[model samples]
Target: MELKDVDLNLLLVFHQLLMERRVSVVAEKLGLSQPAVSNALKRLRLLLGDELFQRTSKGMEPTPYANQLAEPIAYALSTIHSSLNDKQSFDPLTSNRKFTLGVTDIGEIYFLPRLMVLLATVAPNVTISSVRNTAVNLRDEMETGHVDLAIGLLPQLKAGFFQRRLFHQQYVCMFRAGHALDKAEMTVDEFCAADHVVVVAAGTGHADMDATIERKGIKRKVKLTVPHYVAVGHIIGSTDMITSVPERFARACVQPFKLRYVPHPVVRTPIDINVFWHAKYHRDPGNQWLRSLIFEHFSDQADAAA
Candidate 1:
């Protein structure tokens, strides 16, 4: 079929239908009637010479041909939208934009609350979707646009990536208030002897703290290992376990859980927390605006430290 035979607007309709999978919902979103959407779908099917969608109990399921066309079509649409955005200055106050951010569980603890509060005043219509930064699959996700911005200790991203350091973080040992260590001068021996609640990493399911300490010839008696930092507060609060966490996160938990942090018994290496994005989106107006806002909100140390 020729380009003259198909309306480009139908591709927009097709893309939205692919996303929503229901004609009625797509119509509502596109401000068209359901019949109009159906007619557009029929045109799409005829132009492509394929039944792009097949109706089933689970809404409209895309055919294999549709699946094959999905990525390039979406990329084209995104390019067009971004091109349009390039013609105007990004006005955060007037734009309704949704951004996906990949953050470590610790980052979510320390940053999300404050960031949301700031956005409420500066860009009320903007929305955020946060994803876990598991170290693994982050590069792929960012390159594919599944993740727009990632904030974490990602030293492994070396090429085709852009990054700016938010802060340098050191470790601190935390325990519930009134714990035995709080009353005594804490030593390495005492810290290692105590039962520990460690956060296993999101991707590997292994606690990196264990390896970091082991390299220094120290071993803690780990009684519990969890997959996220959010659970550490309640676990440490109710139990006799201690955890070593980033200073920022440890400080944030102190007030709410009646926790106290001391210097890490073993000398720990400071990790760089960075904001990373794919090079493909380097010049995107929306991405650039969001990156600037995030850096302004979180970082004060140095320029492009990572």
Candidate 2:
């Protein structure tokens, strides 16, 4: 089929369907009636001579053919969008786009304060929405343009993603200011003997809080287990349990939660914290501007290495 036979406008609907995997969502995103979106899909199906997507209990599951076309089509559309908007410079002061960011709870605590302060003056009209990085299908959300960017130690954002290092953070032992382990130094044995709060920081890929301890035949007395780092400062402050947290995060909680920290005995390589975005929108002007803003205010790769 020649390009003339195809309604390129249908590609927009097609792309939205591929990302959303639901007819209603694609319609809403494209500002069309569900039947109009369905009609576009039908036309594309006829032209391509294949069922691009089919309804299933798990939403619109893409055909192998549809999956095959996803990348090239996305690249083409992004290029066209870039060209069309090339002359219209992104003015942060006047643009009111809402950028959705994917972040863990700990990330929200560590990154948002400084980010919002900078945005308040620079892009007062712009808005920010946040989704849990651990939420279902976050990668697909980011790829589809639902979630614009993510920041953290997410290992899953590898392929089809672009990332820049913000900083490297090592694990530190955090506890109440008056806890028993509040001392000049802590040995591995004392660290093991103390009651621990096992933080299952689910999407950061560092949830195995005991891997290093178990490597040395050390068994920890886990007094409590929690799914997030948001309440760690509060819980550890009011209890005798000590926990391991990222160094910067610990520093942030120090004064607010009346916490103290010492070097963690387990001694592992530092984890990199980075800002991540889908390669599909890497060149989009607004995305570019926000990422630059993040890098400018938060990135400390050079200082961390030094």
Candidate 3:
């Protein structure tokens, strides 16, 4: 089809239909009457030469052709919408935007509380969702707009992605208050020999603390392995087990759980916490505003902590 002959508005209707999977819902989302949306669907079917959607008991289901066209069509509509909506300034206080962020448990503990406080003050209408960062297809997720931003110690991120250093975190040893280990600083042998609770997420390897210990030609005994760091504090508070985690996280977790923190004899290597996004969104105005807000919040927090 020639570009001049094609009605681009039909693509918007097609995208809404694919997203909602129901004509009625798509019509409501686009603020168009059902018959108007149906007419647009008919035009899309003729333009694409395929039945884009078929009625089923589950609702409107996309045909194979529609499935193939979904991403490209949605991406095109997004680009056009962004271009037309590009303004010199963004009023976050009045905007109701939802941002999806990819972050690790450590980040959720160390950064999100302060970030939320900042958002509450600056953009109360803005919503935030945090997804777990595991060993998965991060590059594809960011490229396809599945996630708006990722925060973690991402070492092997793909090229063409933007990464900004948020802060460097160091390791600390955590145990229940009044525990024997908390009486004094922990030696390497004591740290290795202590009954330890290891936190490992699904699809992720051993914890970073383990890797740091291994490099010193010493091996630590992992008495238990759990999926999240939140669980480690619970187990450590009840048992004689100790865990090594980021100092910021340890500080946050200890006060609530009545736990104590001790300095480890081993040299603490700093973990780089970074904010990553696709290069496609590098120039997007809304995205730029959000990124600036995150940096400002974290920078202020770091300065206060120092």
Candidate 4:
């Protein structure tokens, strides 16, 4: 189909459907009647010659064709919106922008509290939402504008993505303050023999700490495997199990619960946490302001720690 023959507004409707995954919700978001949204979806399907979405128990799942169209449609819409608003300045103080971020449980522990405080003081109208970072298709999620930013040790990032290193954190061995192992500095042998709680998120590989131990020809026995770091702390507190966590998080956990950090016997490779965004947003004024704010907040944190 020719570009002139298709309604450009249909693309906007298609984008909303892709993001919300439900026609009724998309209609509510766009302030259009449900029938209007359904009509637009039908037009989009005809123009694209594909059933863009298939009804699923969870929601409307995107077809392969719809997935392929997501990025270019989002880019086009963003470009059009930016061009139309070229004369208007982005006033963060008055603007209510919702930013969705993909972050790991460890990131939520180390960064969210301070970040929220900063936002409260500077951009009170801005809102933030965070989802777990899995070892899945993050590049697609970023490119399609599903997630505004991702914060973590992303091992493999695709091209055309911009990344800024936030900070490097080392792992520390943590145990209850009066635990038997807390009497001395933790040795690799002792760490491997201790009953451990391993935290593993979906799609993320098996525990990096365990992998490090295995490389030393020692096997670390995991007494339990939990989905998030938040649960790991609770389990460690109630039981005699030890867990290796990022130093910043371990420090925070040590304060409330009677916990102590013993130096990790294995070589601790500092995990580099970085913020990543699509290159298309690199020079956008709103995006630039948000990125700067994140860096400033994290920089202050590093200084305080030092």
Candidate 5:
């Protein structure tokens, strides 16, 4: 409990252990020997007066005390590291910083191209890597600094986070440019009778469009399902099957994929897209700069407001 009684280095080990759970895995990740990691754990246990982890068939499982300590300890370590490394101001033009973003498939299709062009001119040395984003693990990933920013729809970010509205999107049906429905006004019956290609975002096997259709007691004749929106264009552009996608993403895919978009027959509220970051990194200069860059290039406040 006393700062002097605790070896600050143990916190780093503890944080790694919290993530890896198994001592051997933690040791490998931290570049420490197994015995060293074990010794650190022993010392941490004595300092905190708790059996921080319990060995089980499922590897090392955190005790309730360790679970309670994980977030705050991770945040504290992250803050310390950021404060020590951050320069007076972030010079994006010259800094060689790599940022990891958690972005949905649709977002990646729509935003990454534009962002990369802007970064190329303004921050040539900076780089970006994007991973699939999900609401389930977003909070923990952000809290632990595993993901720098999560850009997409994240209704799960209820607290301890800050978000900015990037844009609002509505669904529209897309098909090959010369498909039978190309210029015809699509009726509800025609929309339901046509074979459809559905996009299951992030391979989750669920679609909001399907849910909305089900709510309206409308069953779509789904012919194929693909995991990413990027593939939807290809599958739909070459076949009679149509897929509904976010309007902006559909528009972007139109020319390259030789597809045409029509208003979706379903009447549903538009989905809100937002960029989220943890409160811990809210003011970090590097994070602030990257966030601002994204906002400036991608955010559509006028459409979002409307």
Candidate 6:
């Protein structure tokens, strides 16, 4: 059992087989005959000393050993492929390219701080700028290549873009640290009775949340209104106001703004935060590196889906 005894090409075949399951599908994807794929799987079985994959009505399914090897093997293959096929061979340490990302204001608050910190050490020359995803021209900008990537709950970009799920975040009720609503649990009436600072963020498409709440006949008292989430923290922290926000935003703002949060009394669907890029730059090395960095650092489902 040695690296010399294994054909690295078989790993690529192994990777594709794990993805497609059927030998014919794997052969078609890899531009080989079905027999070639079957032979590669046979070699993989002998080299690894495991059955690897078994055929069933569900198509080819990985054995326990194959499942055990999947993560490390996929990661290794991706790293090797990126290393070999990097267009212009991007070097993060030396590349001075600037990348602009489209994100909402809350996106900026949650994504940029740690990103900048990481760049300062590993990619000091690289620069990042974030623009509001609410911009009317965001889609055109991304298509025409002005915006390199986008991250947030962007339902607008789902149609014609490549996306990877980073995590799913739930809504939380946020208020000042010492506010009365800080209790472990509160009733719908208690939540609705509190003075609220409402944020009418455009393009976030949260009307469904309102519709759901309305259907439940639960309504909150509105004490103030704002156009965005940036000021929600400061306004609620200083006043006896409460608002429902994404869990990460609440977590990020809680300690710094001296705020506290409890799970929303009303059950709400969690939003998926994803990293999106246009197909035009899908193979661009710098784009790939940046996307990988974000997905690696911010994705909560990395083990499950990465």
The candidate scoring highest on lDDT is 2
Clashes of 6: 0
Worst 10 residues of 6 by lDDT: 204-213
- Give the number of the best model, judged by TM-score: 2
Q: Any idea how many clashes model 3 has?
A: 0
Scored against the true structure, residue 24 in model 5 reaches a CA lDDT of 89
What TM-score does candidate 3 reach? 0.67
What TM value does model 6 have?
0.69
TM-score of 5: 0.68
lDDT (10s digit) by residue, model 5, range 1-306: 568877888999999988888998988898999999999999889888999999999888899999999999999999999999976778999999999898887778888998899899999999998888754487798898888998877667769999998877788888999999997457789889999887666533236657788889988898887767767877887899887778898888999989898888884478888888999998878899998888876778544554
C-alpha TM-score for every candidate: 0.67, 0.70, 0.67, 0.67, 0.68, 0.69
Clash list (residue pairs), candidate 1: none
The 10 consecutive residues of candidate 4 with the worst lDDT sum are 201-210
Question: Where does candidate 4 stray beyond 4 Å?
Answer: 1-88, 205-207, 304-306
Q: What is the clash count of model 5?
A: 0
User: Which residue pairs clash in candidate 2?
Assistant: none
Error of 1 at 238 (Å): 1.7
| Candidate 3, 1-306: lDDT as tens digits | 798877887888888888888889988898999999999999888887999899998878999999999898888888998999977566898978888888787778877898888889899998888887784477788888878888877765659799887777777889999888887688888987888887865443226667667788877788998778767778888899998777778878877789998776674777777788899888777678888787766753656666
Candidate 1 lowest-lDDT run of ten:
201-210
RMSD of candidate 5 to the truth, in angstroms, is 17.0
Q: lDDT (0-100) at residue 77 of candidate 5?
A: 98
> What's the CA RMSD for each of the models?
15.7, 16.7, 15.0, 17.6, 17.0, 17.4
As for TM-score, the candidate ahead, 3 or 6, is: 6
Model 2 error, position 106 (Å): 0.5
Decreasing lDDT order of the candidates: 2, 6, 1, 5, 4, 3
